[model samples]
Target: MDHLINHPGILTAFSVIIFIMLLLDLGVFNKKSHVVSNREALIWSVVWISLAMGFSGVIYYFMGLEQFTQFQSAYWIEKALSVDNLFVFILVFGFFNVPKEHHHKVLFWGIIGALVFRAIFIFTGVELINMTYLPEMDLFGHAARINVVLSIFGIFLIVAGIKSWFAEDGDDGDKDFTKSPGARLVHRFFKVSKNYDGDKFFTIENGIKMATPLLVVVAVIEFTDLIFAVDSIPAIFAIAPDDPFILYTSNIFAILGLRALYFLLANFMYMFSRLKYGLAVILSFIGVKMLISPFFHISSPVSLLIVGGILILSVAASLLFPVKE
Candidate 1:
């Protein structure tokens, strides 16, 4: 809270940047439904990453290396976990047989939902952490305060990581997305047409207003992001449980770039075939950090180094041992 209050300028800058970029993205570049080309996706990806990096530089200047590293660590962690979301996005679009041109619109609305839900989760989670700290006690010859919520989240992440590591490929590829809770929620509220009406989320059929598949797809995507947040949100809490500003800013930046990433890598997914392993390791490592925080502290720079190294190696390994189609 104090971190947020003290950094009003940075916050304003972040807000302005996001607002302008979103306006340019939706109002100018993507005003119409169209398939996003690889080249355009690449440029957007670089732009978003550079923006995130530049923001971290500002943090370094104003808040010191610690906050900068925290931002970097959280940004990359959210970015990495977001790859899993891309896989799910591919699945959702494919299942619905959604047109490539419509993908951007769905993802755009999905990210808008993420910006809201992530703020809620990060801010609420921080408040929960602030309230759940147990009385100070000696542990292994040192005094410490254990956070109950974080400990639970730690155990959950460890289990999630182990499940991810051993999980079979295409686990979601065969599922029925129409049965998705998001889809169900949309269905519960409105009558969904069997087909899409261009990229519009609603249309008139039989002289009655009805929802389109695009809207259902967007709903499913929103729900999907919320589910992924369970793992990612808790994972980042290990980095800066006390600072929602660092967590939320880094998170939103990572998420706002995802639509581009999805298009850029959708065809070249073999390049990230080994990424699940890296994500599993990162999740487990953060989980361990949370569990051991009461007794030992790991600095942000070290965590950043470990995470960056793992991501690099994972990409290298993926290229070297590419998945055979």
Candidate 2:
């Protein structure tokens, strides 16, 4: 529960670094819109992973082993949960028929919005937990103050994980943008074009400023990320409930590389057919851990090993026994 790196200097430094990296990524490297090649995606994916791992080393050097373990646990959990987000991204892009060349544009803006929103969610969650009653209770065979807010997060995760496990895949059902309340509200208030005007989200047509289909797709993508964050944010909270720095940094690092990860895995999504079950088990385990944390303390290393093992086994199983068409 010790916040070793909760200093203004550290926070400010990380914020600046993240801002500069984002500028370099979007402004310099990906300034043009084109289909992201496998090689490019693979290379960037490694870059992002290496950056995250390197940050863990920095944490270990400055904060010691305990904090480093917490960061690793949070990072792995967030990264694993993000795979589900990538799957949904494929669905969203396909649903809108977003051109391959424009996909990065939408995702770039989507990630920007996500970073802002997730920061809000992280700070808000920490404040709410701090406001709750802190009663010394026996948790995990140790005397610790039980957090009502965290327990609620645990319950939500358990429910969500169960629901996700039983949920059917490839079932878009009857949902459409026209049926979406947000889409309808936007359409009512703005002038919308039926077709895309290149990759522009806005264009001047007949002397009137209008929104393009691309704008709609971006809106949908942003909204979808917000929905996904509902689950992912809490999952990370379960990993590092006491340290907002660990939680936020891990979440942001996992998300920053998602565009490349999306490109790498989008074509091979079907190969990981059992990933949902693994995710379900992981979420459920974390939820149980949170709930029982008052009575049984599970160390961060144990958590990391278990989560990594589940994901690895699920992926291996999927590859060994491919789903039949």
Candidate 3:
């Protein structure tokens, strides 16, 4: 942690490599079409996710065992949370009727924005956690604060999970990011078009100008990301204990994979109906763990086990009980 915080080379290198990759992805690979195929998406997904894990290993080898553990825990929590974003992305694309090839472009921009916003968030969060220290002996009080916050998150997940579980029944739930508090404010002030023009976000058609549904999809993607940020950020804290490097690296890697993940998993999303249950359980568990972290001091090993177990169980359940078309 000390090494990473002090040495600035890591951030610079990470940015240069990631940006270059995106250029290749958009400018080279996904240069055409808006709709992506599951196979192509999965290949890209594997490439990036493998890269991320490999990067984590490098950090571990260079930094130390301790930092690596922190990174892994944070990574696991974030990876799980990202699955929720899958459903949200599906909704955004469905509502906007975004073409497959164009989805990559949207996510390309999204990754850029998300990484920037999250950097600010990580820096601020790390500073606060470091500066503020509660009485060590008053484990009771410390635990209580942790519990209160975690419980709130847990409750949020429980509700979200329940909503997701029933979502298949045609309940729209709170799935629309465009209707979020901030997005709503933006919409009220901006004059927007009523329909789409393929990949074009804004254009003049005949005598009138219009904003494409693609633009709306982009808006929904960004807003939904922020909401996801809220849940994911807290979840990571449960594991890595607010180490900025671990938090940031884990988050960025998971986010970096999202575009590819979406492409790969889009078609098979229904197959993972049990994933909702897995995510729900994971979220609810993390919320509980966070709420009681101080009281219980749950070992990282235990955290790892629970997280892994839930994931396996969920995947198994999904395989066993796929949503039939």
Candidate 4:
């Protein structure tokens, strides 16, 4: 497979688009911390999704159909898996009693952290995968090279899928987020104030500068995304394990849109009550794909169709079978 990174023009285009969007997102549109309305969230969601699809078109133009489908598959997988992250974000905000106005700021910073961490995970994972390919040998009459890392990741994702399938609702709702390692890491390093001071992450109380609950919230969010990546990153690896460029670009585009998505869906949680089941199937399907890659290749187009179909069905089921309030 040809690596997208080899195309300098495409790389430049991807970088420029991301840079400009983020600049507009933080430096311009959201310059002030204010309550984001549903309309605004909807508009931004459309903008981001359109940008992602447009960029995928660019990929198809330059990298051909295979890479385009790879991008689509990875992008949707990350987007689907990330719904679970939004659920946690809601709980975290509620736990901290975070003011409605500050949710975007928290999610923005959380995504920035994700952009960096995901690059590290995807690139490092690709190199590890390259190193772990077993010597080719006959396995049931066909010679194939199996990657040890991908095999382990496959098993892990399958287990994660099963766990997600049977997972109970409100599992994290009643837990104390203050006990989270993310919060503890913040408390160990800085004196945290008892109250918030506007949208500031730091506050001065009694002539002492201290971290506010808002900062603790960001830390928790960052740590939460890192943990979520354990599943999400590996799932994407099942799509384009050898092409870090495809993996990272698609993973980032999906993540960049999540803040808007969170706001848009925050009030419509019941509409996706059945999404976990769909995500479980997607994860297990990707895991099985990875496990079988040595014996049979699943074309990216088929993978894209399956993933898109599952997502559509999940949302339709959620609407039709509407979870009783």
Candidate 5:
């Protein structure tokens, strides 16, 4: 893993491939503002999943079974976490009354921002973990000294999971973007249009540049992604704390498919009523695993199976025992 991360070529190649794919997605495949059909969303969903698995196959061939399993575990964790993001996205778009045709545009830019921010979060987190090498502080009652940063992340995740598990879904009417710090900051710095201008983020009016509501939507989505990344970045670190290559590549791939996944499942989100519980359980499991990692090392394969099983059972339960209208 250290060797892979130290190799600049591998990192550069992956980054370039991701950029090219994004360009093609935005520049070629989706050049117009139109509602993405359910069929199109479904097709793209399969394509993205196939592409991710294909990359996993490459990892298996080049990095062997262990790293491949690590990548799979991180991918599943990030993908599952992304489902929670989609629920918020639905709320944001509905709140703003963003046109259906413009959803793709907002998501496309939101994902681009996510990639940049996630990289920053990963590098910073890894560095912080590395800096906690204090030989003087022999803590945690274990043979190896406990990493304070990792411990903090584990506790945060466990607490967050518990809170999410018990938190009731709030009414959408209660959400007020104007009150959000991010929204307030954006509004203070830029002049925004009263309405959307056909998916455009900016337009010139009276010799001054003004942002459209679409820009505000993108800003809110980006801020929301940053919040989600706080949870997600640490979860991946728990899976593969030492391997930034696996951590980053898996995160990017999961995010790459998120736009398609959102559209594919948005209408059907109600059917998966138990997904939040599954995510809560997964987060708590990983948190506990991180906390006890000195005493117990969960294999990546086992982690993958446990996570996959939780997701499956949650979906099955949702469908079998749906809330009555």
Candidate 6:
């Protein structure tokens, strides 16, 4: 913590490194925007996700499993939450009639926005916690307590889950979904082009067509994740709250793979209708846990096990009970 804080320049350097790497990813690896074939998407997806997990091994070897446990829990949880985001993406994409060819571009920009948000949230969260000098994480002047903020997050997810469960279920369970604040605000503040003209986000209707409905989908994708920060950030703070480096780096990398994950799983998304219910349970459970965590002594490792177990079982169950049947 002290080393990272003292050498704050490392964070900037890290961002620059990520940028250069992204340049390489797009420029060398995927210069021409080809339809992300399953084989290609899978390869890149595996490479990135494996790298993230490998980083977790590094954390475990150095800081211990408790810390590694926290990262795994956060990474898995965020990945799952992003699944919900995908449900929304499918909706927004369908609504806008975005072309398959242009989908990658939209996702690319949307992911860039997510990276920016994570950087800010993790940095500010750590700085604020440090400044407080609260022996533990005390909001005001007391020991860290799961105050109303946490309860609200818990209840909000519960309600969101129930709403998702019952909301007008479209083909295979893609409901009208938008949990991202940015998406909502943009939808409210700006007028959207209703029809998609090829890959354009905006069209002049007579002659010229701009980026079109595609850009809106991308923006909505970006915004859809705001509420995610609300849930996962606190969840992470629950584990190794002081290590800002772990929190931010793990989150940044996990998200870096999301676009690839999306393309990789795009068509098969319909098979996982049961996943929403599972994620709802997980989110609601975590929210409640975060709310009550202050009262009880739930160790990070235990928290990790419960979360990981839930994810594995949920996946197994979803596969066992397919939506087609």
Compared with the true structure, all predictions reach lDDT values of 0.94, 0.82, 0.70, 0.93, 0.85, 0.68
Give all TM-scores, in the order shown. 0.98, 0.93, 0.83, 0.99, 0.94, 0.77
**Residue 85 miss distance in model 5 (angstroms):** 1.1
How much does each candidate deviate from the true structure in C-alpha RMSD?
1.1, 2.1, 3.5, 0.8, 2.1, 4.8
Ranking by lDDT: 1, 4, 5, 2, 3, 6
What value of lDDT does candidate 3 attain over all alpha carbons?
0.70
As for candidate 2, its clashing pairs are: 139-294, 139-295, 140-294, 140-295, 140-296, 141-295
lDDT (Cα) of model 5: 0.85
Candidate 6: pairs in clash: 137-144, 180-223, 200-211, 200-212, 201-211, 201-212, 201-213, 202-212
Q: What is the lDDT of residue 261 in candidate 2?
A: 87
The candidate with the higher TM-score, 4 or 5, is 4
Q: After superposition, which runs of candidate 1 have C-alpha atoms over 4 Å from their true positions?
A: none
Model 4 segments more than 4 A misplaced: none
The residue-level lDDT of candidate 1 at 137 comes to 95
Per-residue lDDT of model 1, residues 118-206, tens digit only: 99999999999999999999888899999999999999999999999999989998999999999999999999899789999999999
Q: lDDT by residue for model 4 over 59-83, one digit each (tens)?
A: 9988899999999999999999999
Give stretches of model 3 more than 4 Å off.
1-3, 138-170, 173-190, 206-210, 323-325
Q: Which pairs of residues collide in candidate 1?
A: none
| Residue 144 CA displacement from its true place in model 3, Å | 10
